[model samples]
Target: MEATPTRHPRRWLILVVLCLSTLVLIIDNMVLTVAVPTIAEDLNASAQDLQWVLESYMLVFAGLLLTAGSLSDKFGRRKMMIIGLSLFGAASLVAMEATSPGMLIAGRALMGVGGALVMPSTLSILITVFDEAERPKAIAAWSAVAMVGLVGGPVLGGALLAQFWWGVVFLINVPIALLAITAAMVLMPESKGPWRKADPVGMVLSVIGMSALVWTINELPKGGLSHHSTQLSLVITVAALIMFGIWETRSKSPMVPLAMFRDKVFTGASFSLVLLTLANGGLMLVLTQYVQFVLGYTPTETGLAFTPLAIATLLFNTLGASLIAKTGTRVMAVLGLLVIASGFVVLANMTTESGWGVLAGAMLLMGAGSGLAMPAAMAAMMGAIPDEHAGVGSALNDTIQQAGAALGVAILGAVLSSTFTRHMPADAPQMARHSIGDALAVSAQTKDSGLLDAARSAFTDAMSATFLVGAASVVGAAVLAAFLMKGKNSGPVPAESAVDPATEAESDAMLTSL
Candidate 1:
């Protein structure tokens, strides 16, 4: 008889280690945002250069996630986690010592590779370590920590920046990573699904396809859809992804199970997550700049201003999983999306003179909505996957989220840029028309309040327009979730319907060689 699975005795401790690992990666991404101006001045970088510095990391991270997930499933999750931590630590050191933009960007890219390896392993291991009955709470806790990391990043970076150079932000990751690696080694159990052979062709195709797609999105703000390079990238992205789908469907040992998309619960949950990330990512990006440029808040104050959002997220994250037990995934998801939409509507009306209380209320609503919806959506997706395929499943989840966030920033940023440009005086300097930061700098140098006023007004209009789009998107997601996600009000997801035993066994056998 097959042995019955048992929960690890040290699972909670292992979770702490995993949370630390996650915090470092999440913080690394956001911390850089607060330091962008300092870094730009230090490196003599252009706006395009700054964009690449951010996008390079996200692109590489998204591209490698699927491969990393599959590899983790074949190898031991703990082993892969260790390897990722090591790489991340090394990259942090490199970033800390970098004196040039190129060197810093290179370090960030390496960090992305490490992050791709680390991210899915954490979720996969959590699924493996916890029994089904306890999984939701574990996921909720994990989600809570992840949210904290997201909101805390700017605050942490601001604190560091107040007393040190921008490099200190990158440097902070090194010791934390080392500690996580050590703790993981000592506390986490080694676990893997059946071995699988590496799919080199699939990996190459996915990387190329996703990289091209993201590159196209990133470049759209600068050159619009008509640029030759953007058009070429779009074509390449489409062709490569199409080829990847065909190959995966036909391959004897597919990297991803294309059949999973047929499940409405899975598809709905996944798509909702994509939309959620898209809206929130764009909201955060614009708001960060708004507080800094238009409102003239210092980095530290700006970070503190996000406290309401963070608190709301924490409270809802803790409560969401339990609420899911009562109301089911569908209700929680739809409700959360509706709440988020309401918050976006509130933000759409914000102006330069809007009080902090008004901003905080909008943020709190968005945070609470996201906290409730995201965990439920993630739970639905995770429950739909078989136990053995946890790594790749989690990877798919992460990939969609990262891609969505990248698209959000790209598309919304393009909107803001174009609208601001059109609204600026025709004689405004090129640099002033490039971005709010540039416009503010120009205004400061020229000592022109009229120029500053124009920039602020343009930005406010752009932000309002973007928030309306976000609200509409969230409402659409709510409608989709109401219809597409299948679940009855109550307890754990029905297992027989959730996992196909035959397919799971087949997948295990196919992955036996990696």
Candidate 2:
């Protein structure tokens, strides 16, 4: 038997650095969500405008992931990370000083661009830093921190908003970026891979396709299917995607190697991740509103309510890593999904007056389940691909995750909004008799406390219904784990030997040299 290599001592340090960086990115993401009302109040922006402020960042970030990954490989990972971090900082400043919604959105887009660079490079760095035997642990820690960032984004944002104005959230990134950049410079060594040239065409196609798809999803609520605007966007998006696939297939240096998905593990892992993300993203957004707007929790209270999720995520992340060695992939993935489904079911039953203890338990269970499932999914996906393509693999991971979150928000938001509108107080509905748009407008101006409570009831019902959908999604993922994610870590490594030794050594040194 091959002797297991000692895990690098610096592994923990690398994870910490990456975790901190990810925290900054995630905090930036939802910080704005908590601050949205404040921002709207301060900037005099409309609901639609605020939505764009958030969606634009995600749109640009998700759209550019492939290009960023390939470019990082071609130019240099460390250089790209530093550049991205710096840009992120600069963008934060822009966000901090924004005098208009358009300016804020532009800054957010720039932040997304920085995020695009940071996300994949961080993952690639982690993969090289730890050996296979040690990877699950490292990834678990990384994944847990990431999950905290995901859930805590709103919490942190809420906390910041409680004390400071909305700009403070953007300013918060400045200090974190300083730490990350400083540490990275002193610690992270230079690394590069074998891309003789960048695939500009492939990059363009990916951007176009992802942009169209996301835009289509975002527009669906406003337009629905019958709206000519929605139809036009959907048609254009589908056409763009078809062109993107054709371009990727033919490109000599494809951004996403079409062959990668040929492996069942790769396709299955990606597909499962997409579904998981969709449910997670959408549920979180709606839940925040439900807790705050409907349940009438203050932002700080909302943040505190989610502490269980962060703690549970951390615990499960560590636990899941430890279990992966013995439990194997199938058992771990299935177990995680099952647990997640249970959490959703629990959440489905949540009421405005739900007990803290019960709510905490549900959040903890969901966090644990998510922490368990994500690392396994990521490991399976990355494990199936070649090391040389780690950048691409990481990009694929983020791509699915971001896409899932966006899709989740789009689908669930539409459902929740529609349901709320339809089930609103009879008097309120009568008041909205002009048009759905007119009713929506009237609903916004509603101040009647009784009518508000009625509306809240409707929103709560819609949220519960959505949680059931999320539960169903998790169950579906579990079902897939049973059939598709067969075998232990026994699957053959895909064409990862495509990575050259010199390049591997350089990247490894980059990750571990400190």
Best by lDDT: 1
Off by over 4 Å in 2: 1-9, 425-427, 430-450, 487-514
For model 2, residues 424-457, the per-residue Cα lDDT tens digits are: 7666757553223344356678744566556666
* Model 2 clashes, total count: 2
TM-scores, each model vs. reference: 0.91, 0.88
Q: Candidate 1, TM-score vs. the true structure?
A: 0.91
lDDT for 481 (candidate 1): 74
- Model 1: per-residue lDDT, tens digit, 387-504? 7788889899998888888788887787777787888888888999888889999999999998899899889988999888888888888767766776431124434333244533
